[model samples]
Target: MELTLVDLSVARGGVPVLAGVSLSLAPGQALVLRGPNGSGKTTLLRTIAGLQPALSGQVTGAEDRIAYAGHADGLKAMLSVRENLTFWAAVFGMRDVEQAMQAFALLPLADRLAGTLSAGQKRRLGLARLLVTGRPIWVLDEPTVSLDADAVALFAGAVRAHLAAGGMALIATHIDLGLDAAVLDVTPYRVALNGVGFGSSDEAFL
Candidate 1:
């Protein structure tokens, strides 16, 4: 799959967060969106994922073409890991939740309540949900949060394998996800009150 962002900007409460950000991505590639807190990383990710509306510019990618993992795991607090995956699989119309559970190494925690799992475990479970969806583009927001080195490596390995399988990703991370992906910065594209948008700057978001 290929995605093109043409002069995209996002605003919250009428204050511009991201301004005139444009980029192109294709399968087997990854673009890291790196920035400090409140620098529009999350906003950009949300816009790309269609969770948030774009203030200006155009987002023409297929709506279901991308799967998003936000800062929150978005797991059902009352459900067990297995039940959560099962629910998501059914929601996404997957035929096999067990396959996805095993893929993410959640077999052991299948019976554990999602709310009771550690942060790392929860993040892994969240990532597992993405696998079950089978979408080609992954929009991850701080996917490594609360993960230990080993889990981080596991996440990175999963990402590498995805890219190898012709998948693409857009990651917004404060910590290194170790994906060897290219970086893009939204700082240079911040919308000024009087500017036309994406005004000819090439600041790196990574």
Candidate 2:
């Protein structure tokens, strides 16, 4: 499978953030987006995940095959660790959460409420859902925010296995992901901050 963007333009709050961006990724491949803060990395990832739309241009190969994990853990505080994964798995038409638990070292805390887990644990639980979602393309935004070093390694291993199994990942992160992937600097795609949106015909260029 492949995900490709052609001259994509994206916006937030009805204002353009990224413009004329293009990239492609194949199975068993990853693209690590790196840029200074406010460079539109998150907007780009959200567009690819279908959570948001591109203002202009096209995104192909990412129709119904995306599993997006954003900065928030997205867990129900009252739900147990196992229940959390199970719920998402079922929502995605998957039936197993065992592998997800084991993948993120969450089995020990399976019955623990999500609200009680430490930040690192909660982050792992969030990541574990990716496996159960059973989607081929993973769109991750700042996936390692609160993880410890070992947890980060585990996350990297899981991503490696997914890619090895012909999955694709598009990650927006500032920290190292400990993977071999292409790095895209989004600075150039950032829309000018001169009070003009992609809707404007005459605007400043950076």
Candidate 3:
């Protein structure tokens, strides 16, 4: 199934940030979202991931097919590396997390508690959760936040493998992962203050 967004308008804190946004991603494809800070990249991704409501338009073919990894690591601090992956796998009705663990080089740290892991290690473990999800579309926001150069390459490799296996990715990151993917700049879709209503609260969650 192809993920399609048509004339989509997404809001942050009940205020419109982007409007007239549209895109489509078929299997084995990836799209990188680009814009300055506070340009609604996170808001758009959250809307597409079904984490929030869209102010207008449609996001079709993405009902239960998206695996989203936002700013947070989404890890259970009390669980060990192996246990964390196992937990996410179970949540998605999967069992084997060996591949996921191996992909991120977590074998050596498998017995380590998530809270005791270094920042980069924790991020890797979080990204590994995507593999066990068995979802077709990956919606990631700054996925390489705490990753080092080598860790970034590992992520790139994982993404490449996922694409080779016919999965799609929609990422919002300033760093280039060296993937031959299409880029979508959301600058044109920025809504003027007078064009849409503004909420008193900021989009702090982003």
Structural similarity to truth (TM-score) of each candidate: 0.88, 0.93, 0.95
Instruction: In model 1, state the lDDT of residue 80.
Output: 99
User: Which order, best to worst by TM-score?
Assistant: 3, 2, 1
Residue-wise C-alpha lDDT for candidate 3, range 1-206, written one tens digit per residue: 99999999998777888999999999999999989777889999999999999999999999899999998999999999999999999999999999998999999999999999999999999999999999999999989999999999999999999999999999999999999899999999998867654343444333
| Clashes in predicted model 2 | 0
The lDDT per prediction is 0.80, 0.88, 0.92
Candidate 1 residue lDDT tens string, 34-81: 665556777788888897788899887647888999877999989999
Off by over 4 Å in 1: 192-206
User: What is the TM-score of candidate 2?
Assistant: 0.93
How much RMSD separates candidate 1 from the native structure?
5.2
Model 3 root mean square deviation, Cα atoms:
2.2
Pairs that collide in candidate 3 are none
Q: Determine which window of 10 residues in candidate 1 has minimal summed lDDT.
A: 197-206
Q: What ranges in model 3 sit over 4 Å off?
A: 195-206
lDDT by residue (tens digit), candidate 2, 1-206: 68999999998777888899999999999999988766777778888889877899999999889999987899999999999999999999999899989989999999999999999999999999999988999999889989988998999999999999999999887778779899999888887868654433222111
